[model samples]
Structure formats: structure tokens, C-alpha cells
Target: MKFARSLAIGVVSALALSAPAMAQDDASSSGPTTNWTGPYIGGSLGYTWQPNTDREKNERIGFDTNNDGNFGDTVSTIGGANAFSPGFCRGFAKGGSAADGCRGDRDGKVGWAVHAGYDMQMGSLVVGGVIEGGRSLVSNSVSGFSTTPAAYVMTRKLDWNAAARLRAGFAVPTGTLIYATGGVAYGKFENAFNTTNTFNTFTESNRKEHDWGWVAGGGVEQKVSDNFSIGVLYKYTRFNPNDYRVTAGQGTPPSLTNPFVITPSGSTTFARTNDRFVTQDVRVTASFRF
Candidate 1:
């Protein structure tokens, strides 16, 4: 009887322990829990393309009263140089030449940039900052003449823009990340002119810094395996108040003009009223994270 009782007790105890082991085995067979968290750094290289848009608007109003006895005609103003002058024998002249002279044209170009950033993992989201710089080739042209001041319009080309960014993203899977970023940017512009009299020259070469703007974009990253991944991103950056100034004065050199000749010429003026710039870029990159 005693032997049987001991054997029964042993069997009961064994069954109790085996039941929890079987339950644990059933739960684990479903799958191991996924662990998603870490700090990562990587580098990327890809073709970057950007479209640059720059614009300028200028207007002037003035009435001159003098005894010059001759009045000028209205001319086509291309390139925004609006003015008129008197001919040798006219009190006032009216024609399409003055009205058409001061109008300007707009053009845009594509360019590239290189970038680097860091991502911090929290739950299922990542946040970081990035800095990038690159070369730009974009420009515009405006060709016409002034009737009041009897001048010509010029060309302006903007090149080289850069930016810094702050980024936030989420981890959709073990290695896939999606993000958005925004920050400040800077750029430079060059204005050139080929007058009816002068050769091509730079009226203004503006290198601007401290230009404030915001940028926002998103990117996707996927891991090919444990340590390597690739991504593609796009960003839009607008410079804050990329304002500039230009003064086109002093056209007739006194040393070149004779006092006896009927110099029907007046002053040539081309000034910057206002200017602003905005740009966008897209690139593909590959990175390796450990």
C-alpha cells in the first residue's frame, strides 16, 4: 500500500510540471517576439535633381520737367528697364519701341546635392537632422531697350544652393524607415548684361548667406539583410527673403562724349526692386548600418 501511494504521488507531481512545459512549448512555437530598436549611421550616393525658380519685379514712376525742348517716345521695355528720353527734334514721341523694352524672362535648371543624417529609434518612430550642399545651374534672360533712358535689358543666372535639415520618421518593420525633415537653406545668384553698347558683364554677383527657409520631405529605407539598406528621398527648400539690390547708373562717360555733338542720350538705369527663390530636389542613396 505504501509503495503504491508513493508511486501515485510521484506521478501526480510529474504531470503537474509537464503541463506547464507543454503550455510554454505551444506558445513559443507561434514565433519569437520581434525586437525593433537601435542607433544607426550610414552614407549614400545618388544622382540629385533640382528645379530652381527665381523671380524679380521692378517698376518706376517719375516725371521730369526741364528745358531740353525735346520729348521722348514710349519704347518696349524688356528686362524691366523702363525709361524714355527726347530725340533731337521732338517735344514728345509715342511708339511701341518704348512699351516693349523692359520685359524680362524666366528660366529654371536642375542640379544635385549630397546629404548625411542620423536617426534615433523610439518605439516605432525615428527623428534626426541632416546637412547637405550642392551645385546649381539655373538662370533667366530679359532683352529690351529703354526709350526714356535709352538703355537695354540684361540676363540673370542663379547658381549653387545648400541646406540643413531636421528629420522625423517611423520604423514600419525591422529595417524599413519612413521620415520627414525641415530646416534652413542658402544660395547665390549672378546677373549679367550685354548692352547695345557694352559687352557681357556682371552687373551683380550676389553671394548670400544666413538665408532662412524651411524644408520638408520624406524618404524610405529598406534593409536587404542584417547590415545593408538603400533609400530614396525628396525635399523642398524655400529661402527666406532672398532679397537683393542693383543700381544701373552712370552710362555716358563725359570723357567719351564731345560737347559739340547733339548727344540725344540720357541716363540708363536698371535696379532690383525685389527678388526671391525656392527650389526642390530628389535623390536615391544606399547605406550600411551595423
Candidate 2:
């Protein structure tokens, strides 16, 4: 996060310093004015941050203790109380005991995208639309610790994403365009599960999904020539929640005498709190205008 902040400050500073020089050049140049109307293709490389990666809550662990097909029956201790009193954590578990804690949180990673758009200049204002596709390596996970002295880990990753947006901005005589953009986005997510509970047979399902969401951001583009431009953009994206399930199969011998038998014999299904996957990106872009 600190690196992202520093990069942003440096880019804004560079743009600030260059604006004056660009304005001076515009004032002295005897050349034709730069036109903002055009079709363009571009690509961007950036660092992505998943700010909520470690924010996990309301995680549930269930079992079907009875031979019946329902998991609503809570797994209870020999004394007839909930067996998950050890609670949950936001990382992978190292061992069966709660005292072992969990592994450290995962970090954000690099992301890249390719885009195409067209712009129309009306007086000093430019309006346009763009489409983009990209991918990121960001991942997150959560773990539930049970009194059985076991850890159940659930993980999710952002696979890929695409967006279509409308852009509107003011173009100065100095060849700089300042713009704001917002639009609909789509993405895919991959999920997986792990556990330290060796006594129970686990079945995992609903491990991947395609979801819809939205994105919004703004950037400054500086035209280096009639056919080329460079810019930096900051965008925030979010996706609808998804579901994943893990079932503890019937214990050996199909009896309560089996420690692995979940009293209800049902699956434990959960979605991230608020069912939202969110990310922020800072990218440096280069474009070819036609």
C-alpha cells in the first residue's frame, strides 16, 4: 500500500511539473492545434491492491451428524454444546490446535490490461467510450477453527475481468486531457478449500464462478504526438458475491460413535461477508491513436 501511495504521488508530481512546460510550448508553437477526435487502442501495466483481502467474517462450519441428509444439525461436543468454540481466522492454519494461530495474510500483486476506445471532440470537451480486459494475481482466504482441534481453510482468487465504460473530459490547448470514467464490469473467481481434519472425509463443490459488477475512476492523458499518448489511471472495481460449499461425508461405520460424524450430515456453505470482491488499481498506460 505504501508503494502504491508513493507511485501515485510521484506520477501526480510529474504531471504537475510538466503541465507548465506544455502550456508554454502551446503558447509559442506555430503548428496546427492537436485534435482530440480519434479511435485508439491501449494497454496498461499496474499494481493491484485488495484492501479487503483480510476482512473476513460470519464464516460457518457445519456437519451432518445424523444419518439424515440435512446439515442443519449442529456438531456438538460430548457434553451437547457447539464444537466450534475456537472461532475463525483470516489465514491458513498451521496445525490442529488453536494456539498454533494462522499463517500471515497474503499480499496484493501485479495486474495488466488492454483496452480500445474512441473519442469525439466538441469545442474543448471530449466524450468517448472504451472497453477493457485484464487479469490480476490477488488472492484471499479464511479459516475456521473447530474444537475438534482442526482448521478448515477457504480460499478465493480473482481470475480475470473486463469492463465497458463512457469517458468525458476537458481538453486543454496544451494537449492534456483530464477525464472521469465509470461503467459495468464482469469477472471470474476461482475457489479452493483445505483442512487439517484428517478424521473426516471432505467433499468440495461450486469452486468457480462468473460474476458482474462495476468500476469507476479518472486519469490524466498527455498527448505526445498526434498518434501517441501516455497516461496514469486509478480505478476501483467490485463484483457480486459468490458461494462455495464443503461437505463432511458420513463418518466411518455411519454412527455417532465415529468422531468424524457430523450430527446433521450436511454441507457447510458460505459466501464472503457482504458477498463482494473489491480491488483498486494504479496503472501506467500507453495508447496508439488512429
Candidate 3:
């Protein structure tokens, strides 16, 4: 967040300083300069995607194999009979369970946002702040069991999001303004988790929440008329982490390699997950300049 703030300040300051030089250049030209000072409202359409994170952090977003109140059942799977599992996951079987793995993906989707901002134009330089918001239509679901014989799965949706940021641009000889933007962002999300051993299967659906973070990026805007403009903007928004609570019952899955082999008794387990949301967006915007 602090990095975002510093970047915005630096960009705006740089643009403001260049205004004097731009004005000096304008004095030597005879052609009429494009006007860009004013308040404007706009809407945008875009595509959004989320990048995958490190497995260590992702492993933290796990479910409990045992049904007790303890959430220490890490997300690693047990592939073979000799696979080692610490704590309650000891002697856990992995294969033969309905679940094959534990994972999730942040899919891409079509999205849009509305924006309102006031720009201060000085010769060929423009600087301003904008507040805009919209939601991405991406969804992800991961369900599978580790060889540890523990089965687990869950789903999440990156719903509505918004941001307020600073924008700076260099207006060329034509009516086009190439700009850069960065600032703070916020988002709302929905999540659900379900997993269990052969003896215990648990489901936790319907959890909606929100988080705060930052956004940064840029684009180009072109004015076709004094009162209307069209542009494309690209941005990356990062949201704080989200978590959910779940429970798993104990079960002793029979070994596939040896039917006579019995793992152990399943215990009551408690679990929680820490998952963050990040998105990349490419948007085409239409604005009404007042």
C-alpha cells in the first residue's frame, strides 16, 4: 500500500513539473491545442484474471483432516502407503478416496467499471485523481485428496471491486493523452469449502466478505469531440487476505494396495484458510467530459 502511495505521488509530481516545459513548447506552435481540463464521468468494459501465488501460502488455505478443533492439518497429500504425515494426519491414506487433489484457480472473465475524476490541464500535461469501481466475473474451485487419505475441496469467487487513484498523462500534438495511474483499491468476495475422510465429509458454503488493498496501472484516452472521449486502461489490483472456517470428521480409508491394511481412527478436526485475491484488468472506457 505504501509503495502505491509513493508511486502515485512521484508520477503526479513529475507530470506537474513537465507542464512548464510543455507550455513553453506550445508557445512556438500555431495549431490550436486540445482542451483537457474538466470533470468527467465514464464507463468501461474489460477482461480480468488472477495470478497464482506460492504454494506455501496457498497451502495455508487448507481444511482439517481430523474433526477436532485443531487446524494443523496442512494441505499436502499422501501419495503412497509409506507417505509420512505429522500430527493427526499420521497413517493417512491418499489414493482410492473420491478426492484426487487440493487446489484452486482464479479464472478469467469479462468485467466493467464506472469512473469519475477531475483533471488539471497545463499546456500539454494533465494530472488528476479518479475513483472507479466494478466487478470481475471470475470463479475458482479446487477439490481433491492427498495420498494421506484425507479428502478436501473448496471454491471462491472474485466478485465486486473498486479503486481510487491518481492519473498523469502527456497529451501529444493530436487529441490523444497517454497516461499512468496508481492508488488504493477494495473488493468484495464469496467463498465455500468442503472436504472429509471416508468417515467424515463436511461442507461449508455461503461466506461473503470484503477486503482493502491497492491498484496501479495506465492507458491512453482520445478526445473525438469536446464533450466525449474514448480510451483503454490496464490495471492490477491487490486485495488483503480472506479466510474461512471448516470442520472434518475422522475416517480410516482402506488401503488400495492391501485391502487388509487399516490406517487408523479418524478424529474431529478444525480448519481455517488464508487466501488473498489479486486481479489483472484490461478495459476500454467511454467518458463524458464536462
Candidate 4:
């Protein structure tokens, strides 16, 4: 009887100790209760206002031919009228200009774009890359004409400022992060010439399309549940201005020899006038934690 009782006691003690040990092992095997950290892909929509500094150009052409004092002024112009219309010199009877103001001045128009990229987290530091693209409208003008006392507007169609960016950030909470980013940028400027009388020439060529700049901002991420999280962020970027040349005579003949003498040595420049931009975006992310 004594032996049986002792055996029974030993069995009960072993089970009691084994129960706690099993529970501890299970908790340890589950690992430290860490949040999800790895590669993530997402998209964001936001408002952006990237402005280039206003630029003006003027030149004097001795129009001894038309002494109304209309010396040739070759100012770079963009959006007033399409320089490609046959009726651009004089407004069209149908009511739309053909000359789309090809080579006069550019109008200062605000524009926007979209973005998508991947992010990774290593402890507190976060790094990633993004691909963003969209369209923009920029303007230029030349008013101080030697003879013609009128302001001309030139509008260039900015196709899109597309680029890839590298990001670095910090994890603030169990499900929150903040970061800064920058990278290489590129885009196309649809170079055309237009005027009030003749919609004569249109030229579409890509030039000096690559640039590098820096972007800085902060954002927050939150976990709504185990598999999904939402985040909101704001960023400011300074983009490099691209420079290229738009040569006319590629379209139709002008009423005169040429509006202005073509410069073989002159350069076309697109400057970032007031390029500080702010972007606000909200994104949804899905994840599986180890």
C-alpha cells in the first residue's frame, strides 16, 4: 500500500511540473510577440503642386521690312494658342486656333501625378523604392518686346515626371512608421510653336530627360487587424529642372523668312521655379507575420 501511494504521488508531481513546462515551451516557440516586418507593395493617390520659377526671354529682330516697329522677339511661349493651326496667325472662323501658339510663351499651369512602390523594415529602420508618374503643364512668357508692346504666352505640355525613389524611415510603434525619400526623375516636354496669325509648326521631340533630386517627408502606418493596415503620409520634394532645345521649321512655312533667327548656340532651359511640393496619401497594406 505504501509503495503504491508513493508511486501515485510521484506521477501527480511530474504531471504538475510538466504542465507549466509545456506552457512555457509553447510561448517560447511562438517567439517574441513582434509585429509584421518584411517586403510590402502598395499604391497611393495625392495632390502635388510642383512649380518652376517663371522665366522670360527677349530678342530684337530688325524688321526693316515691316517698319511698324515689329522687331523679331523669339520668346519661348506655350499654351496661348496651338502653333500647329493653319489659322493661328488670325483666329479661326470655326472658333479654334490652329497655331496653338507654338513658339511664344508658356502659361504657368499646376499639375499632378500617381505613385506605387515597395517598402522593407529592418528593426527600426525602413527602406524602399517607388515608381511614380503623371502629367504637368508649365508656362513661359516674354513681355518686354522692343516694338510690339504686348505680352505673349507660351504653354508647354509636360507629359509626365516619372521616376524611381529610395526611401529610409523609422518604425514608431507596433504598427507605425515615418520616412524620407528621393531618386532619379525623367519626363517629356512637348515642344511646339504657336502664334496669333498662323498655326504653322509643331515639333514633338524628347530631350534632356534625366535628372536627380532629393525628397523628404514623414508618414504614419496603423494596423487595423492581424492581416490589414492603413497609413497616411506627407512628403516634400525638390526636382531638378531639365533643359533642351526646340527648333522650329519642322512644321509649315511662316509668312516671313522666319519669326526669329534660329540660334545654333542658344540653349532651351526648363527651370524648377518654385518646386517645393507637398503630397498627402493614404494606403492599405496586407501582411503575414512570422
TM per candidate: 0.55, 0.87, 0.66, 0.48
For model 1, where is the 10-residue window of minimal lDDT?
86-95
lDDT of each: 0.45, 0.76, 0.61, 0.39
Residue 7 lDDT in model 2?
Answer: 70
Model 3, range 77-117, lDDT digits (tens) per residue? 23434222322221122333533332335356778889899
lDDT per residue as tens, model 4, 1-290: 23323433453444344444444544565422224454444444333333233322221111111223222323332332322123122111222332232344333233445565666667778787767666545433221121121212223344556667777778644444456666665645543333232333423244434445555555555443444444544445444333433333422543332332232323222222222222222222233222
Question: What global local distance difference test value does model 1 have?
Answer: 0.45
Off by over 4 Å in 2: 30-33, 53-74, 253-274
Q: Point out the worst 10-residue segment of candidate 2 by lDDT.
A: 265-274
Best prediction by TM-score:
2
Top-down TM-score ranking = 2, 3, 1, 4
The TM-score that candidate 2 achieves is 0.87
RMSD of candidates 1 onward, in order: 19.6, 3.1, 9.0, 18.5
lDDT of 1 by residue, 142-166 (tens): 3433343333444444466667777
Error of 1 at 141 (Å): 4.0
Error of 3 at 101 (Å): 5.9
